[model samples]
Target: MPAIAYYPPLPLNAGISAILCAGFLFLAFRKLLRDKKRGKATLSITLAAVFAVATAGLVVGSYQQYVVMNTWSYDFRLEVQPNETVRESLIVPIPGESSLLAALHLIAGTANWSFIETIHGRGLYFQFNGSAGLDALFSEFAPGGAYHNTTLTMMNSTAQPGPLTVWIFYSGGGGVTVHFASGGMVMPQSESIAPGWRLHQLLFPPVA
Candidate 1:
């Protein structure tokens, strides 16, 4: 998958912007009231419009922080032995060695996720469709806890095998869902992500 920018939630940024705009508008209004000059109404309305736009931006930003942040862990290991295909080893981990898939089924059918989308220091991409996929979307330090030192490794058990390039995407939420649900996940740039996720034959690539 190509890299995507990660825009984590930030309520404080919005709040601060709003407070600043309000304060500025208040000052402008006070100045206008004290001035013997003309055009007081025009200046006040201009400041009010600025305040309104700032307030709207703050609200939307806050809402996005609430959504698009739900995520969790699917812990499972793959042992790509000699003469083995890579796709079949798609195993996600479970909590407490518990049945993570089983729990997912309880939440919804067929957990929606992309195939190893862009990998990052935090985790790989996985998005749910409808309600089922939503069940698997956990937040930072989610229920299962965050996966650290997460790396994709490849080994050339044989000298004759050809190398492979696996593309990863930051999958979650379709276009419509993303547009409606407070924007979407902040995916890092593809360049930033490629080096992090790329696993050369038998080794992890260096981080860019």
Candidate 2:
């Protein structure tokens, strides 16, 4: 699948602009109160109002960006081979923002697996080894779709011998759930997901 560029959070300059506007607003208000001339007082009041509005707008935008950066959630289930048993289930607490690379790194770290990045054509994948070797491909959220998804396939090896299937489901509250299972297992329905919840994907070297 083609990787789509993810939207970035509001820049730090936005927050800085908010702080500066707030300072200007305070100064304008002080000037308005201290000035004795009616004309100068009117000008100071106008400047204060403009600065107040600008500060409010920037502060709101910055708060929204902060929320988006910290609130994304992820869930992963690793099904053991031989009988498709769910051996390990983990709810990854993504500290700040949601990045496929970060999530994969957390998973690998928790499982004590070697996380290797493999570049295939124009795409990137994760090849990790635990009890068995596996290749994981995380897909960008579908256009106009509510959820992001990933697929993990077992690599052919002496222990596993063949590829296994993995399925993903997204919950309404902006959480991603990944289920690893055999090909014959039935896929589960997606949970409710919030509309327009943007999840960021970390693509190396960037993608257009």
Candidate 3:
């Protein structure tokens, strides 16, 4: 099984990793001391090595979470009718300890969007945190460019990728228009969005 990731980095993940590392190391050390007292050098060394690896894993995991929380930036292309434009790179100051999901919520605020799954758009977008049951419809794909607007197709099908569209009508109070990527055809759909960027069900369901 793959190593579990800590979502909502910082205190949650950091704390968990810390505890795991601490508790495991403590056990490993006790075993080593006891074995050493008995002149069991081989077993003691093995336990020590395992303990080292565990500590390293925790350190790496904590760093990954930190990168996502603070440095991650999500660039969403808003698609609106007609020829009007709105700010694209959404960078709202949220807590560094917040998860990517929380960051997305902050940027989107209370704006509601609609998503339509196309006939061939039956794939799923695998997420970094790896929550099996999470819907790809609302999950982000990849980044496109510097603004990093690519999409990673995470479909659970063996068939070739199809098309998808999202019609986002921002209605928090006034009107918010976006650069729509019709059919959910985000650039580099085979790639992944940079850390920090989030993808929800920004697509309006296709109507018959």
The prediction achieving the highest lDDT against the true structure is: 1
Kindly list the per-residue Cα lDDT of model 3 for residues 1-208, writing each as its tens digit: 9999846644464456556556655665676677544345455455656655765776677677655545534333332221223322222111122222232321222233222233323221221111111111123322332333244333323433444322111212222223323233343322222223333233344558
Which runs of model 3 end up more than 4 angstroms from their true locations?
Answer: 1-39, 72-74, 78-208
* Candidate 2 lDDT tens digits, 1-208: 9999754444455555556666655666666677645666566556656756766776688777666555543433332112222233221111112344344433332233333222211122222222222222333333344343343322212334332322221112222233332212322432322222222121122245
**What is candidate 1's CA lDDT for residue 176?**
15
Q: Ten residues in a row with the worst lDDT in model 1? A: 174-183
Give the poorly placed runs of model 2, Cα more than 4 Å off: 1-35, 73-208
Give the clashing residue pairs of candidate 2, or none.
172-192, 172-193
Q: TM-scores, in order shown? A: 0.33, 0.31, 0.26
Residue 82 deviation, candidate 2, in Å?
A: 26
What is model 2's C-alpha RMSD?
15.5
TM-score of candidate 2 on Cα atoms, chains taken together: 0.31
Candidate 2 lowest-lDDT run of ten:
119-128
Residue 69, model 3: Cα distance from true site in angstroms? 1.3
